[model samples]
Target: MELKKRIEKFKTREFETNKEFYLGIEKGQNPHTLFIGCSDSRVNAEILFQARAGELFQIRNVANIVPRDDDPDNNLSVVSALEYAVKVLKVKNIIVCGHSNCGGCAAIRKLNDYKDDLPNTAEWISQSSRISDYIDGKYPDMNEDNKLVLLEKLNAVRQLDNLLTYDFIRQAFDSRKLNLQAYYYDIGTGDISIYDYENEFSDLIKEIALS
Candidate 1:
């Protein structure tokens, strides 16, 4: 009922007010950025970006994962959007945004617990298992809460490396035709920390890539 009312209000109020803007974009879309974010309900891309309609193309998925080119189980849904965003839309920026208290990232930490009941989720998030293992091995003394936070941030940045595995993405990045960034949004604090492709996690991501 609440959602239906909101939709009705959007049609009667918001749409009427911005009728021209909406109709102008109806013919075609020219979004400037490709925002790849988590499927977390709390992380609303438009609200966070303060963007209007037709401004951003988006891909939302568990843990905000982008499969590497070499990944045998690469999910076509995500890769297809990415390819279209870059090749067809010619989006100048690609932002992979992960957020705090992410259930998906939390699941990756205890993936074995879900392997039986949530097999598909377990397999999907298993892509970032190496990142979790690295944190455990390197920060053995870090508390659970802090470890999760670190994992969330690193996992966001790691997707940038995964994005580079695509030849077209790498070419665009190398030629400065495309910009890739990772963002860690703290839902509670209303803060977002942005990371460039070559950030603190670059070395770690390189090691993981080599492995």
Candidate 2:
């Protein structure tokens, strides 16, 4: 009932008031950025960036994972969108955003436990299992809670490296035609930390990529 009312309100109020703006974009969308964000309800890209319709293209998935170009089990859905965003839409920026307390990241931590139940999810997030392993191996003394937080942040940043594996993306980035960034959104604190493609994890991500 509440959901229906909200839809009704949009039709009667917000939509009607923004009819011109909406109709102007009906012909086509020219988004400036491709926002790859986690499928977390709290991490609303539009709300966070204060962007309106037709301004941002989005690809939301568990843990905001971006499969490497040469990944054996390539995720067609994500890669297709990425290709379209860059080649077709010509988006200038791509932001991969991950959030705190992500269920996907948490699942990656306990992936074996879900292998019998959520097999697909387990496999999907397994791409970032290397990040978890790195965290554990490097910070063996860190508590689980802190480890989870670090994992979430690092996982977000790692996707930037994955994005660069594509030749087209790399060409655009090197030519300064496209900008790549990773964002860690803390829902509780309403804070967002932005990371560049070449970050503190550059060396580590390079080692992992090569390995």
What is each predicted model's overall lDDT from 0 to 1?
Answer: 0.93, 0.92
List TM-score per model, in order.
Answer: 0.97, 0.96
Question: What value does the lDDT take at residue 192 in candidate 2?
Answer: 90
- 59-91 in candidate 1: lDDT tens per residue? 999999999999998889999999999999999
Off by over 4 Å in 2: none
Off by over 4 Å in 1: none
Estimate, for each residue in 1-211, the C-alpha lDDT of model 2 and write its tens digit: 6999999999999999999999999999999999999998888999999999999999999999999989999989999999999999999999999899999999999999989999999999999999999889888999999999989988988999999999999999999999999899999999999988886667777776665
Model 1 scores worst on lDDT over the 10 consecutive residues at 202-211
lDDT of 2: 0.92
Question: Which residue window of length 10 is worst by lDDT in model 2?
Answer: 202-211
Q: What is the TM-score (0 to 1) of candidate 1? A: 0.97
Candidate with the greatest TM-score versus the true structure: 1
